[model samples]
Target: MSDLVAEHRTRSSDWRSRPVTWLVGTGFALAVLSLVGVGLLVVRADRAGQPAFAFLQWNLFLAWIPFVLATCLAAVHHRRGPRPLLWALGGAWLLFLPNAPYILTDFIHLGRRDGAPLWFDAALIGTFAATGLILGLASLLIVHHVVEARSGRVVGWVVAVGSLVLSALGVYLGRFPRFNSWDVITDPNGLIAVVLERLADPLGNPFLLRFGLLMSVLLLGCYLVAWVLGRGILGPLNGRVTR
Candidate 1:
């Protein structure tokens, strides 16, 4: 036990010593911003009519949050060299957990609907399929930027290949995704059991996923869009954050 504890401490110290600690701190800060941003969006969603900004944040999460987090985390971990992409893939799904309640309430329309939508099958397909594309494309850009900044050839390649593979898988499984309302967090007296039953089979597939053919086109288009927006426009404004 003592040996194990000492070994753990050694590893912890090594991690702390890494220059990537700053990046890790930045990532955690971004995660906090995501929560705050999402919370505001939820408030807006609960109002009689949702605002465009609300949908923007919501769609940003749906489209890009997972990928942003994945790229950051993967780049940090890629310090060790190319490896399997399981943790980053798993991170995408785990990231969905905290956002589930908001999704049930806002996206699933549990508050307004007496039961789940009839076209749930199509909805899930569109939701998660689009999700994978957004996330995947965002990951590609973020990882590319990080690699350019860090001068890691292998890390860049791993991120490129692994992100693509896991993204493909994310598109596949995320389609037709199922969930349980699991006791509405927003509605106290909500019909928990009925809500669960209603949302249980609600769909979450990608809208343009179409076995990734459509997704590829859309993803590539978005990549160009992001370059224009982030690197071209915003980069000049942000003190020239090169690479």
Candidate 2:
């Protein structure tokens, strides 16, 4: 256990010392900037005496929930906690994880609004969605690394693929059924009933299945692309000389 703790710290420290540190810092800065842009849009709407689409701010906040939970799981890994506890933390993280990327679905809400240019509204939603995706991806990699440390790399990859699939289902539920993460705790029986019904007649709910599959593919592709780009950007830290 002590060895595990030491190893976790060593890796974390190494990450902080490497060029990856700068990249992560810049990513976080951009996310913040995106939020700031959203705020500006809200203010602009208010100045124009228009509905601000304030729900977007709330959606962005919901997106942060999973990211924060994943960060907690990462911190727990460094503590070398019991396996059961760690798994529980990971499960909770997974439950809320879909919320992070769910913002992308908000684009469906985009329409012509009085006093707001359509293009500006589009840009605002796009920024929030992008920031939400970044948060999800960063948190996912954090938890993935923790899994990799304890299990094999193959298991880590398996977990990543499985997570993307499950997250897609989660997003569908949130977007259509209007289910929230807290509903799992507050209305477990009802939620379970709905889930069972859907599973029992998967063909009956073709739209749900198709939506989940499509989202899973989209998220998987984004994660892989970003991961490759991150590696490329941090090639120096990986000890490869890049021209």
Candidate maximizing lDDT: 2
Question: How much is 152 displaced in model 2, in angstroms?
Answer: 1.0
Task: Estimate, for each residue in 20-93, the C-alpha lDDT of model 2 and write its tens digit.
Answer: 47435845875676668677676767867876667777877777777677767766665666778778889888
- Each model's C-alpha lDDT? 0.44, 0.77
RMSD of each: 14.4, 6.6
**Model 1: residues with Cα > 4 Å off, grouped in runs:** 1-138, 146-169, 177-209, 228-243
Provide TM-scores for the models.
0.35, 0.83
Q: How many residue pairs clash in each candidate?
A: 11, 0
Show pairs that collide, candidate 2. Answer: none
